[model samples]
Target: MKKDRITTINKTAETIETDLLVYFAVEAKGKMPECDTAVHSQVKKAFELKDFSGKAAEQILFYPPARSKIAAARVLVLGTGPVNKEKDKGAALDMLREVGGEVAKVCASVKARDVVVCLPPPKHLSPALTDPEISAGALAEGIILGDYRFEKYKESTRKKTDYPGLDEIKFVCKDNLKIVHQGVEKAKNAAFAACTARDMANEPGNHWTSADFAAYAKQLAADTGLGYRCLEKKEMEQMGMGGILAVNQGSYVPARMVVLEYLPENRTETILLVGKGLTFDSGGISIKPSAGMEEMKYDMCGGAAVMCAMQAVALEKPDVGVVAIVPATDNMSGSRALHPGDIISHYNGVTSEVVNTDAEGRLILADALAWGIEHFKPACVLDAATLTGAVIIGLGHHYTGLVSNNNALAKAVEAAGSLAGEPVWRLPLNKNYEKQIESDVADIKNTGGKPAGTITAAAYLSKFVGKTPWAHLDIAGTAWEFTKKAYIPKGPSGTATRTFINLVRNWKPGKIK
Candidate 1:
């Protein structure tokens, strides 16, 4: 872990000395001094030179000190593609990580002990498709993430080589260092929570069960000052939580409903956050093929993000009341497994016909959302879930799909996503999509066929919201990535946790105008 602080250009450069000065090259163009001197001809010519454009390849150029001139020990220039085409915040941030990782590799190759990254002035850069703060935050985040090394299990490898660890990092910025620092701390905290969630979610099913997750939630509440409660199987049955009970029938581990609340001082409005906690999704009696069953471990990422977001909120003490509800269980196949066409009564007294056991996320979320509405009476509600592959097919892994009834609430979430550097794209929630979830056999159906699967899932959960301004974030595609990009790692991205925290921290009632 490295500690970083931003210093201005007005500050003395002698305050810190390093082995290299890395500069960002936009469209193969390097920065040049403004002075008109004959000896500067070489530097000017170098700036005018162009390099071949590659898909995502980076080109590094080193400039050594000239005679009698003590230039930086070394100058490393990084290519960032054509400036106009690379202005997308997410893409630009990804480039920064690639560049940073290359720098780290070069430093290790030469055994250089220290390095400093010049955070360029924001004025020199064009506005990213996302907000400016997010771009800056993503840059900082990428540097940190690029330096991550999972060497804990390295002892088993026989290959021997020297890989120097990064000791410190210094960020160079002109203004808003405090605000940037705040964002940095928020990102770090969110990352830590995500790592914890990933570890829990990635554990083997035998090791991590619904009961185990419930106990961990209780422990988190005890360690922190957040309120916590766990509802047992009998309690859920007593409360008419048939959705959870049906999902848990096949698993030996009992279903547990965990609720954690953070009440802020002088709070004016409350927000409810519901997360789908399918600890392991076996597709139940509608068992999925074995090809991608390994990915089932990540099914609980939605619950993890919710838990992590609440943890971050408690740590930051945002000025808004929040209730995080997680319905923890596993969807497995056994003699007791739920069969298609089974009618289950939910907590809100709405009956759902189980059309497909694989569509279990919405089933559990229904109970959690109803619990939030009936208990917290929040002004607004937001739920995140790895609900559908249809979402991934629609939006890919780049953005989380957002569906909401209230335009204001949806926009707020989108803005929060921007500020947190976790982007979201809103999807429509038209009445035609809502009608897809309607059931002829029961009050509603758990699966709405294939068309608009993501929207139908949102609509199904919306039934339990009970007039509260609500939004649904389907993060099935973004919650986890197979490859590293920008600030996110190859595993759990901690997708919407920071966005939710930002939304609550900056929330103001009736401020939409």
Candidate 2:
């Protein structure tokens, strides 16, 4: 998919036959601007309509005159909602993407070859929020969000059915064309990396195990020329990674601690990213119910995000250095599985009482975090994990829960989230929650009380962070989606990959505001 930008809309613009996007907006009822008047009139007359007052997601096609010189066969009028509805900006942005995705789907069904998107003219934007900056932002987001398609596995089927695959998308923008193009390019690259990670994470457990995932990481590093190392169970045991060893006891496959490093030529500050890579979480001796156990394939989403983000960074080649640490293992149930009440020591030399074997994400993260703190000594560390169901209970799939010790780092990460289009909501990590993990038999219990479970989980990982500025992102709910919403397609959401890159790229030490 190639995206190009133009300065103005020319009705006589030479384009491909499948270029379907004819962008227009309703600033007021029955009023159309000069540039959009032709397209708007075509749509209105086709549907025998006076106005698009109450329509949403409505489609109107245009046919050029039999002897006309224009190239396009049809035009698509996307609903931008009413100009005076006090619109939800998020929803509006999402709608724009929805329009794109729907059009792509239509084109794919009909075997269309290419698309030309005539961007909504700046003058058609609502007066209340018509700033070019905001418009460009929304337009960029819409283009990327709309262009996404998860059809890798369906390519063969699609080909057999003669479905049209969109090969190119050209953007026709009047002003700020370069900025819009840059934003779209960045977003598309990030989205492509995320989609790769999401598909890998969504693969069945039998296909993506601890060892297999480590191999995949190594391949990514080799392909991108980033530093890569995988530590086996023996190596980890030598390093005293009891948390990972304990979790791997029941599985046939051994645990792996995979590390990928990206040190730019002009390195300055170091950022460490730790991800929980539970390839197939069967909950060990405390197994999860069979009802939704299939969803556990997504347990590795956090690790996948880290892996993909590292790949993106390597591709983008920012000045900062990045270290990606993923502790890969399968939490399974067997006679040899570690049971409840087992106490395991971590790399930090702190013991954890496994009250519930199902609470295993923190177990792997604990060892990874300790290793990161001890080895990398990073200026700031951010660990993303599908850590707690309690987060799902609190935020559903709308947002990832963020808990950080440094307010400055937290705000920076929040800003990163905004840029990545995966927003985070900061949750309290109060000392009261820390006490919940204080154990009678060990330094801390793996599971805290049911109340504030997510916060306590963050607190549990905090113990291993040492004094390094740290932030924990619990992405259990946000990592996978069963329904399509906004720019996110239904499946693995690739929640934090882009945000992680954005945060690291823009990070500044001792520059908290």
Q: Give the whole-model CA lDDT for all candidates, comma-separated.
A: 0.72, 0.75
Instruction: Provide the RMSD of all predictions against the true structure, rounded to 1 decimal.
Output: 4.6, 3.6
In model 2, what lDDT does residue 393 have? 92
lDDT of 2 by residue, 1-513 (tens): 543432223334434464565555453455532235546556555434554432445555556765655577766665554553435443444444455565565555445566666666554544433544445545554445444555655554575555434566666665666666665566555666676777778688998888877888889888999999999988998999999899999988889999999977677778899989999899988889999999998999999988889877887787778999999998998778999999999998999999999999999999999988889878888999999999889998878899999998898888787656577899998779999999999999998879999999999999998778899999998898723654566778788987897776676655542
Task: Give the poorly placed runs of model 1, Cα more than 4 Å off.
Answer: 2-21, 25-75, 80-115, 127-136, 148-155, 158-167, 173-180, 194-202, 482-484, 511-513
Give a tens-digit lDDT track for model 1, residues 301-400: 7888788787777787777788898899999998999999999999999999999999999999999998878888888989999999999999999889
Q: How many pairs collide in each candidate, listed in order?
A: 0, 4
True-vs-predicted CA distance for residue 342, candidate 1, Å: 1.6
Residue 236 displacement (Å), model 1: 1.7
